[model samples]
Target chain A: MAITGVLRPGHAQIRVLDLEEGVKFYRDVLGLVDMGRDSQGRHYFKAWDERDHHSVLIRQADKTGIDLFGFKVDSEATLEKFEKDLQAYGVTTKRIPAGEMMNTGERVQFTLNNGHAIELYADKKDVGNGLGYHNPKPWGPDAERGIAPTRLDHALLAGGDLDQALDIFVNVLGFYLVEEVVAPDGMKIAVWLSCSNKTHDIAFLRHAEDGKLHHVSFWLETWEKVLRAADIMSMNDVPVDIGPTRHGITRGATIYAWDRSGNRFETFSGGYPAYPDHAVITWPVEHLPEGLDYAQRKLHETFLTVFS
Target chain B: METQKGNTTSVMTEEAYEYVKITIAETGESFDCSTNESVLEGMRRLGKRGIPVGCRSGGCSVCKCQVVKGEYHQHRPMSTEYISKQELEENCVLTCCIKPKDNLEVKVIGKMHKNVCEK
Candidate 1:
């Protein structure tokens, strides 16, 4: 039986606010290039690597959550087979026609068993002309040449039922468990799952409220990039959520910042790989008791006054 | 079929006599659990602890697992309202309501990695 693709070899894709604004932030601020867009007006950007059409796709969305996550499968046939399999399971699957999006590759998409949307496609975009790195062009005092992001690292989402979502991703969708977090109140809060050796391609967060997309992360070429991104955010007066800290699981150094539209983004360096036989690890929520405390310090610093 | 003295249904099937071996990841040992018993009950009977079971009903997926190698059917229809059917096809079965018709190998799916101290 042909299994659905897991971590197909490629870069990450994202949906952004304004195409021009996103381009300015990624290209002018972060120093990336406009790889191009598809018929749907989705913008594609590339890093220093000149191997493909565009590693990142930023589409304009009216909303502020993650629109979808794309993973490359081994072959186009695998994509087709997954489409059939998903149909058999009564999942509503859609095939994006070539040229409809920035990447001309065919893609099959469906909402995950957990409500998060996912796309599996064949990426055939051109590895553009190799543009090497540029110098430390300072956009501000904090602006340093941001480290080039290698690929889409992972997306973090907050949902209500983590176990149900995890089962869908791990069992039905072919993703593997990296680790899980359970709070003291008997609530299973977050889960780290992946398709490849990298610790996790997607991390699910279960908060007290309704489920929503938390953030999307990209892998930086070096630790310097993470610092530089932090500096850029600080310089631009963007709200910094947390970070330049190391996660206990991925152990990667990360910097978290909000975009112009309040979407959270992270630039990180280094993470573990994912493997089939690797034992799934679990961490008690008590270890990090702040409760999804991305910015624990900030929460304690102030309280809301109704009129103010 | 008659009612048992304790108001329990006495309609037992030959399938109840069939032995189903369950391999719990925590214990790394396989135990002989009857087909009529839920996976959670089997674990409890064997004195296996730390499985993080809550809300014995399927409403809570704390007892979820990836059925690696067996054909255990759920006592009630599996609901995709909470988890998608695709996930169920991928071998995710809630142990609280599943009845094994054959030997099964299941890996715990949620929060199985929690530190023993937290449990």
Candidate 2:
């Protein structure tokens, strides 16, 4: 078995305009399982298959966007090592005590060059996915509710310095650039990266702004489920941004929609497998039409400009 | 639901408010949306929270609401994707810029539209 020091996207702390409404949208519409609220009034939710207590944390704020994106490390020692590595790299690192995030453990928080908060943690209470591990069924009743994604898949963020961010993620975090779109001037327009075998565990776009969230993506089981997610969004009156189509970048079926607070979230599924040894795929910035949406082949204006 | 005439109420102030009664179909809760503003603005100002407001510039249409019964004038909506022409012709309005011409009744489609969001 290979080492996955940084396991996966554990949680995303997102801001919503209203807590109750956010709860309604995330729980009833997005079909995530609510893990109860903390003293800070931050709400916790997890996809049906997630064993960790929560993968999505939302707090009510005057504005909409992300506060931090967290990845779970393999162990506490790995988390500590990453923190020290970040400090050695001249990045400021802070520690959030365990229990600060309810069932979550101590987190090493650091800010990226373009102003996005990132964190690594080693522990969180596993509240099993409703099904018992011994002779458990394939799915539960919760799986059929709302737009039930199987798990929190990845995040797409926008920031100005892709080179700096890439250095940190590759040198410090063990992520490999699987695919990238470059400008004629040799600047990276966007990057798709992976830590495990999946195409992209997280991605970033070159933007004029620092610390903007493009979208927090959830993994559905299949393309059919992606379509069902779009169906659920429409049934609930959620405003969609794009898709119910395929993305040319990851070859993933997707639907980008805004939660009630205007923050973008994606229901995504089906991307090709990626390996660390694979050659990095590149695209010209001019070909963003097919690089973005395959069938439409139209680069959406809002896709680039709208970020929370 | 049939449209019914509602008694007009107003509060005289530096920012005079036209009182339009709004009933949330999902919750059966009623509030005044008569700030002479977009239904989204009036909803916010009236302290009727939970209605999502995005790009208050009338872009993004995250605040689309269905008019159960009311009359109001609005400029061209930022996009017809959220509230389609058919829906608009059927009395749907964008909450970001809905100005209630009189006391009226309406339901919020911001969280609950009929079809599965696909046209």
Candidate 3:
């Protein structure tokens, strides 16, 4: 089976506030086998997957949001073909500097359908040799091995211009809209789009204000693994914000929890399949009478209005 | 969306009554609040109005807090679909969703308004 425009299941890319600290957490504490550090100290890690190089990359930055998410295609030819299709759709595309592309370890840059950033190239590094430098007195634990993640699942972004963003995603990137929720004033509030069969590989929320990455998703083996992970969190005394519920859009039962650092995480399983082709669906925004706000409606509680 | 005015309700039932002693870690101020109000609300009531809360719903994860001591009950279940169950069990409760079930103590985990201005 050749990879398509869709991201391989479980591939997630995130930005970290402190690169060095993130390395200690993911490598030393969690025990993820560190692939190696970039010249700038950007660290990469591979999970229990057969992919050549790192599945997750963390770069140090003062602020955090979706830095970039990469999708695996069958070959460079597939990537070039997708690029041409994007141009035909009137979506501007950029070639990444070879350096910035993960394994390429060189400069490379690319812009996707909705102006979302991407870096595509091939150069996975080795993980076992000098790559495994010992920071024995590392921050977390010596014996701690990160719970092997299956893959980097999805990325969620909060955008101000929902319609425009959705248009680029559908027309240019060849993604399908799975489901959406509308605001009472007839504005799109949230949308779930997919480039793969596992429900949605990406989701966008119309922020009441600006655009930013909301959160990211990672899929585990089963519902039991989700709960077992929850129990581990309980044993570690981490606070559980919400969960063990089914999502209305994906129909996937999942849990929302946070890590020690303030970032949010979702562990989900059994989401519905995506549309066969790139099917774009739009829902007009309209005001809901009284019990219409999905956030309040579904949860039956008043969410604090902090965006304004 | 309709720009509705904020409404306050004074109704209280025995089941909705839980007492919590909250200590603002940043300022070292302590106050008591009823279960009817959230931790952020309780902070507001105590005049330590520096906590920045947007999207009072658990969706934002902005009003995040670390439980220093005691158990707090969430008014409703949070969607693990966004945040993970592991994070919740680690004692990272959103102040907006949290209602005191006991005499609880908490620490605001994220950047506060005062911290933002200092820079």
> Which structure among the candidates has the greatest TM-score?
2
Docking quality category of candidate 2 according to DockQ thresholds: incorrect
For model 1, residues A217-247, the per-residue Cα lDDT tens digits are 7777677777877776545434455677666
Task: List DockQ, one per candidate, in order.
Answer: 0.01, 0.05, 0.05
Order the candidate numbers by TM-score, best to worst: 2, 3, 1
TM-score of model 3 relative to the true fold? 0.62
Q: Is candidate 1 or candidate 2 better by DockQ?
A: 2
The iRMS of model 3 comes to 15.9
Instruction: Write candidate 2's Cα lDDT for A1-308 as tens digits.
Output: 58578988899999876677678888888899989998889999999999999999999875567999999999999998999999999999999999999888999999998889999999999899999889999999999989989899999999999888899999999999999999999989899989888999889998887988889999998998888888877566566778888988889998988876667899999989998999998888888888788889998867787677
Candidates ranked by lDDT: 2, 1, 3
For residues B1-119, write the lDDT of model 1, one tens digit per residue: 01111101112433345667888665577777677766765665576753445323343345567778878877533323233466677777657557677888877764343122121
In Å, candidate 1's interface RMSD is 25.7
- Among the numbered candidates, top DockQ falls to 3
Of candidate 3 chain A, the 10-residue stretch with the lowest lDDT total is A299-308
Q: In model 1, where do residues sit more than 4 Å from their true spots?
A: A1-4, A8-17, A128-145, A184-187, A207-211, A289-308, B1-119
Q: TM per model?
A: 0.60, 0.76, 0.62
Candidate 3 CAPRI category: incorrect
C-alpha RMSD over true interface residues, each candidate = 25.7, 10.7, 15.9
Q: In candidate 2, which residue ranges exceed 4 Å CA deviation?
A: B1-119
Estimate, for each residue in A126-209, the C-alpha lDDT of model 3 and write its tens digit: 343222346622223322244434555776666566776677667755677887767667567777877767677777776644
